[model samples]
Target: MSSEAKPLSGLRVLIPRGGPWGDLVSRALRERGAHTVTAPLVDFAHTSEEDQLVDALKRLEAGEFDWMTATSSTVADVLTHHNAVIPQETNVAVVGEATAVAFRDAGYHITRTPERENSTHALLEEWSEIDTGDVLKVLTLRSDVAIPVLTEGLIDRGHDVTQVLAFRTVGVPASVHIREDIESGRINALLVASAKIAEEVAAQFPQLPENTIVACVGVNTLEVAAALGLPDDADDPAHADYELKRALIESVESVIDQSDMLD
Candidate 1:
């Protein structure tokens, strides 16, 4: 389609995370004729309990666990950074497609992922259907600040579960120019992917233009954004980059329709 025919033509979108994922999202936005500003609002740091993490990975490589759970892409990065190995007999489960892709990119195979939603609750529900045998040993790797929903749910099912903090999520403030653009309404939409990013956005950019859209990646993030005082402009249940793109496009179109009606 021509640039003028694209739904997002002349739009400026703010992507709150940088690196490979941000690059991918930026490319998608540009394909739709939107100018993307890539600013990382959150970053990962090595866990404080480095020894504990190392020991857990050692056990993981020794084939002590029957199943391994990866909740985020950062967990996959941790595994790759540590050179952790998963035996052929071990099955790997992920919370969402993004995490599965991360694991696959790290040379790991995924055994299962939630069919409908990309949250821990959804993963747990899916696990109940395929769960079999007695007391399967499970290893769950997650961020330090993440709730232990998946780990607790597995334990309740009578599985031997080991919970390891894979990394720490830290907030990064956006550049002054980026902040100014957001405050001045130069930004057309803000993409929020996680609760932490939402929190940082709320903290850093307290006031947004009345017409600017706050697009969330999933239901969980939308809830967090609502709590943070961000408008419920758009959200995608799939929690994938492509889904976010669709939400942004539809939202912008809706806004344009409303403005046209007013004019």
Candidate 2:
């Protein structure tokens, strides 16, 4: 493995993801000697906004959707935990094995799940075997920050889609403790999980040092950073941040060089 792409040894990384997904990223970074902290930038709850998705759920029960894709377990949690029953014949697709497990535990059999490249485009391609007409509504039970790609693609393919807001994702203003870490340089890089997280963070701190390296999970995330006037590269992704770190192991100097560019 390239040295630079290895675990962020001797570096401090901050993750702004919400829910158990954030915990996964934190654990990966810690395995590489990087001290990790998750100051949840967003929070999730199914009850705060049910009306918007209730119709979608009602539709789901009626077998209105052919394939249901849950972006995160939180979405699955919202579906199965509080009286949400996914419709019959609704072949389930999950973004990752973790989410697939959640769907399985919820008593739903998952038909498709991706091991690598966890993104909407990935999910779209994974299920490409199904003809356009076979898929009706691709219900993506996700947060407000969820992008439009998968749903749009399904539409482009002549399939209807319903992206329900199963939960609200809002930033928690940086706490005094977090600000102290940033200002003190205790945090070396701001690893972003989504474009929304990057956009919101940059908006909150416009004068934030351009020096902060944004190690991200995918292209859309990078776009969000660039849109907010922050530097970004193609490798940034929300779902596979650890894969990037592993890739860096073989190219430490290259990563540090990228870090230098951010600084």
Candidate 3:
């Protein structure tokens, strides 16, 4: 189709996360003719137990840890907030594309990133391939609510793992105006990346209009949304921010085209 006749032309898409991620997704969608609305449903807060996190960072910078892994971009934010330094000897492994970008932006070199699935399980699956021999010390920075899958998995493989809480996810309520827009079917699609955002969406937009397309980024978030009764209208297997936006635009365009044919 012509540029002026882009698939997502005149569509309204709701982006769940804010900051650079939100900006990137919004720009990509807008370029595809979708009017993007950023309603941040979740925000990261400092870990409640500050001392433990601080001590972990100290050890990390002291070359005590042989490897450090960051599962989310938010972990990069936590590292930047504390001015935490990773010794040159410590190799870094990141999971998601956004997380990789965040670490690079924060001046850290990544040693490894999962090829296909950007989940903890995926990271562990490729752990043997990335590090053939057992490493002495490994530090994992993750959200408070995140499971200790990576740590547990690594320990099983005979590696010393020190997992630290880098941040906590707090929900942000959507404004009444945004609520009205979703209830009124003004939003053509809602995109979510985490289970926390899915919970917020489920709570805020209880009665989503039938025409509102719900798109999820990662497998965990998609499963969460499905469990919460939010049908997955569109999904991206890559779980990258850009890929998700592209999928949303393409899916909405298909729906619109089918509707036009019916009319």
Candidate 4:
């Protein structure tokens, strides 16, 4: 498409994340003609149980599991940090686009990612199709604060599932300029990917401009945003860059209409 025909031209969007994924998203947005401001509101830290995490990585390298699940890109970073190796025989399932990209970027292969939902439950639902019926050994790495839903679901599916706490999610304070931008409607849209991100957005930008579009990455995140009083204008479970770009386009159009009215 021509520059003028691009969906997100002249739009400024806020991404509440940093690092590889944030950089990737920013690049994608720029390609579609949007200006991106990345102010990470969350950062991952090592889990307190260092010994347990180390032991799990050693076991993972030793090929003790037939399948391993990585729910987020942050978990993939933790794996890279610990030098965790997955044997060739073990299949790795990544939950979302971010995790798949992160794994591939980290020089690991992904066996599967839920084609539709980008969630753990979707992975479990596709288990029979992805694996043989016989009981299999699996290792799941996730944030410390993550619910044990995936582990419990794997157990229910007759797999030997070992759950390991990989890291902890902590809030990162937004800079004063980021805070001021939200209040002044300088950002046309905010992309919220997780409950924690929603909480951070809520905590950091207590009052969002009415014209600011809030888009959630999935239905669950949408619900969480709603509960936190930050109801979203759009949602995409897969958190695709294209979807986020489309949402921003709609917000940009709305902004244009409001400006026309004011004129």
Candidate 5:
């Protein structure tokens, strides 16, 4: 749709996810004339929690592990950001090609690349017999946003796991602002990422403006937004900033299209 046809012009949107992902999504929404609001819910920082990672590397250098699963490129960045290097002998498993390329850039040799969606569930489908292999420990390098889902699943299969908090989601001051904005009974749309942020919004706002459409990145996030009483009025999206922003516009258009006032 043309920028002038943007129905969300002068509309307000609440964003609660933190980090570059949030920033990118917000920018896209603003480009469509929506007044994007930020309530930085997740905070990311470079952490030195890779101490054991270094030790793991030491073992790898001494020839220890059979394979390591890199969740994403960020996982490699987390390791190298702390100046840690991988053991040349440790085989690499990655969820995506981007992550595999990252491992290659980091001087690692990838033995397995997950073809399924870049999710642990997809990875597990391919390696269901993970514990049966000589795979020592499946080192899952991840941000705090990673719940115990993967860890719990992997361990259930009898595989040894190492937990490292490569990064964490920090709640910022945006929750308070979003509450005030939404409860003020003015605004047109709400954009969200994780269920955690949506939960905080509900707890703080208690009430949101009627006719305010809620848009989110994934189906799971929408499920959480539903639990927070957002209902089924939002547009479906895959969490990418540009794609979600477009979905948000289309949703608003769909709403307006059915309204007599717009006609």
Candidate 6:
């Protein structure tokens, strides 16, 4: 479609994560005629609990756990970085498509993922289907700042769960120009993929322009954004990049429609 015909033709969108995923998102936004800003707002660090993490991975490689749970791509990265192994007998459950892709990319097999929503609660809801046996051994890998929802939920279900901190999430401040654009309303929308990113955005941009749209990638992220006092003008139902782009387009169009109505 022509630039004028594109839904986001004159808009600028901020993608908060950088790397191959951010590049893909930027390309997708450009395809929709959006001026994309790819700024990474969060970075991963080695967990402070190194000994504990190493011991857990050693046990995981020894095939002591029946199932392993991966909640984020950072978890998969930690596993790969540590050269962890997953015996064929050990099944891997992921929280969402993104995590599944990350595990697969890291040469790990994914046994299960939430059929519907991409949240810990959704994973817990499908837990029974993943394992019918009672009192199974499960290993859950997560970031330092992550809530122990999966671990607690599995424990409540009568399973022996071992939760390990795989990495730490640290904030990366946006460049001065990017911050200025956001504060001045040059950026039309901000794509938030996780709660951590939402936290960073909230900390960095305390007051956003009324016209700026804060779009979250999933239900959990939307909840976090709401709690942090960030406006939830749009949300992607799924964690996929394409779905996020579609959500932005639809939201921008909705705003245009409302403005036209007022005029």
Whole-model lDDT values for every prediction: 0.73, 0.62, 0.72, 0.72, 0.57, 0.73
Where is the poorest 10-residue window by lDDT in model 4?
A: 254-263
RMSD of 3: 7.9
lDDT of 1 by residue, 1-263 (tens): 89887766767899876654565567767777888998889998999888989998899889998899877767888988998888888898876444666788889988887665555676777776337757888888888767677788888888888888888989998998999999998986787777788899899988788667777665556688888888654444543344445746454332121111010
Q: Write the per-residue lDDT of candidate 3 for residues 138-173, one digit (tens) a residue.
A: 888787767566777788887888877777889999
Clashing pairs in 4: none
Output the TM-score of candidate 2.
0.74
TM-score per candidate: 0.79, 0.74, 0.80, 0.80, 0.60, 0.77
What's the residue-level lDDT of 49 in candidate 3?
68
Model 5 worst lDDT run, 10 consecutive residues = 254-263
Q: What lDDT does candidate 5 reach at residue 194?
A: 61
Q: Write the per-residue lDDT of candidate 4 for residues 12-78, one digit (tens) a residue.
A: 8887777656766677777777888998888889888788889988988998988888766787788
Candidate 3: the clashing residue pairs are: none
lDDT (tens digit, per residue) of candidate 2 on 76-185: 77876566777667787766544655677678778776444555556667676556356466776666666655556677887767766677666677788887787666
Q: For all the candidates, what are their Cα RMSDs to the real structure?
A: 7.9, 7.2, 7.9, 8.2, 9.0, 7.9
Q: Indicate whether candidate 4 or candidate 5 has the larger TM-score.
A: 4
- Name the runs in model 4 displaced over 4 angstroms: 114-122, 129-131, 147-149, 231-246, 249-263
The stretch of ten residues in a row with the least summed lDDT in candidate 1 is: 254-263
How well is each residue in 1-263 modelled by candidate 5, as lDDT tens digits?
Answer: 76657745656787664333345456766667677776665555654565666676566556555566655456666666656555656666665444555667776677765454545566667764474665457666666655555567777877777756666545555545456667674655676556666676666555666555566545556677777776443344543243444657454333111110000
* RMSD after Cα superposition, model 1: 7.9
lDDT of 6 by residue, 31-107 (tens): 77788888899888999989999999999999999999876666777888999999999988877444666788889
> Model 3, residue 16: displacement in angstroms?
0.6
